[model samples]
Target: MTHALVDSQSLPAELRPYLDGLVRRTLAVCGRHLVSVFAVGSIALQDYRHGRSDVDVTVVADPLIPARALRELAESLAHPALPCPAAGLELVVYGADFVGRPCGAAGYLMDLNTGPMLPNRVSFDPADSADFWYVIDRSIAHQAGRLLYGTAVRQVLAASSERDLYAAMQASVREHAGGEGHLGDNRVLNGCRTVAFCRTGRWLAKREAAQMIATSEQEFRPLIETALHSFQHPRSEALPLPSNDVRTFLAWVGERVDEAATHAGIGDPGSGTYPDG
Candidate 1:
């Protein structure tokens, strides 16, 4: 097995052992079939939080892996010896054929996460029903992702163009907006960032996007600050329950998201397979 060259300091101390085990275990599972693996999300952006972050990884395999190989990979990841120390371990193993495809339906071999408060859950992420956020992930992995092992990120991963990203961001927001419930921080911040990216072609974290947008686009400051305060995780223990203002703000956001979706020409957000329903 090849030892992937990475800045060990980029990962939290508690997660190092788990990451090592993950790499070795994955290599064990796929052997020669494994093409490359990469670090995704906030880690690649160098904005990962120690306890708050999930170890996001993308592993690529030769096309059409056998069921046994997939099972072996999953079992290796869930091994007790490789206990996850952070919020969770999120992994997406894709087939080699996924390269250069839009893959709006991002099927994965293993997509699971275990959190401090949230329970360990394995996702049955069918390609058709996958979340559109994978579009954003694809962009991140291709544009500025840090390599974990094997081939370089840009060489292996296919990136959607800026226009595609805009379409995807709008699609994701439109789905949430049209859905039957209030939008959370994930949706709010994502919506804000989508607007930012549409105008300025930059992918930033929730707070950073909010701050940046609020600067030149002063009209969004109140909504952005509110989203920054609400954050992503549950907050009943720390703050009061949602007020009317929260819902009102999100409603406005929903309208904006829908408008953005229309302008970007991402029609029929509902046409795709949706699992959240």
Candidate 2:
């Protein structure tokens, strides 16, 4: 099976081959049941950081594949032998019919966050997994994502309205924001991007989203810079975590989301899950 999707040069030198293998293996395991696979999120945008990013993938299924088979596929992919290279393999496997249906569709078969290959641990949740990635992911996959196999994303996804897009972003901020969850690197970047997507239709990666917040938006610069630093150089010597700044920025985004909702004429969003993909 072919592995190359987007230009290899766009990503970090060390990380590309691993992703290639991942796409190849995914296609093999899914077989006929796999309608298509699209590499979404940061890697899709060529903005992945070797040590900090996830190999975000979306697997589209046309038929209702049995759960046992899917679990077995996950086991093989997450097996200690063939480990993931990034922080983890963040994969969302769902039906093709649900591509753009906002009211929710057939629950996902697998929402996996398989940890790094070394220890080979995995987090698999196949519950009614619907969230922000729907509209936003479709937009990304169609516009910039790498098609690993099957039909192109454009055909799989229907047109998205501005309100639908706003709802997705708003949910991302609302759900992931509250949790007494400290503003870690992931939170900072995601928070910024959630706000950015609400303002502008463009869905940028965390790094670029952080930039959008920093340069254009004056309020979140300190938090965005700190988060960006944490993302780029997590192991940098003597790097202080911007604890207060992160919390403050998150709260600020919550308010901005309210404005976005009012401005868009949509009510308070309910499915605000963190934008893991």
Best by TM-score: 2
> Compared to the true structure, candidate 2 yields what TM-score?
0.80
lDDT of the candidates, in the order given? 0.64, 0.66
Model 1 per-residue lDDT tens digits across residues 180-199? 43345555566666666656
lDDT of 1: 0.64
Top candidate (lDDT): 2
Mark the regions of model 2 whose C-alpha exceeds 4 Å error after superposition. 1-13, 103-106, 117-130, 133-139, 159-164, 179-183, 235-240, 271-277
RMSD to the true structure for each prediction, in A, is 4.5, 4.4
Residues 141-209, candidate 2: write the lDDT tens digits: 666777766788777756566666666666656555553533377777888877787788667777888
Score every model by TM-score: 0.78, 0.80
Off by over 4 Å in 1: 1-5, 12-14, 79-81, 123-128, 161-164, 178-183, 217-220, 229-277
lDDT of 2 at 101: 53
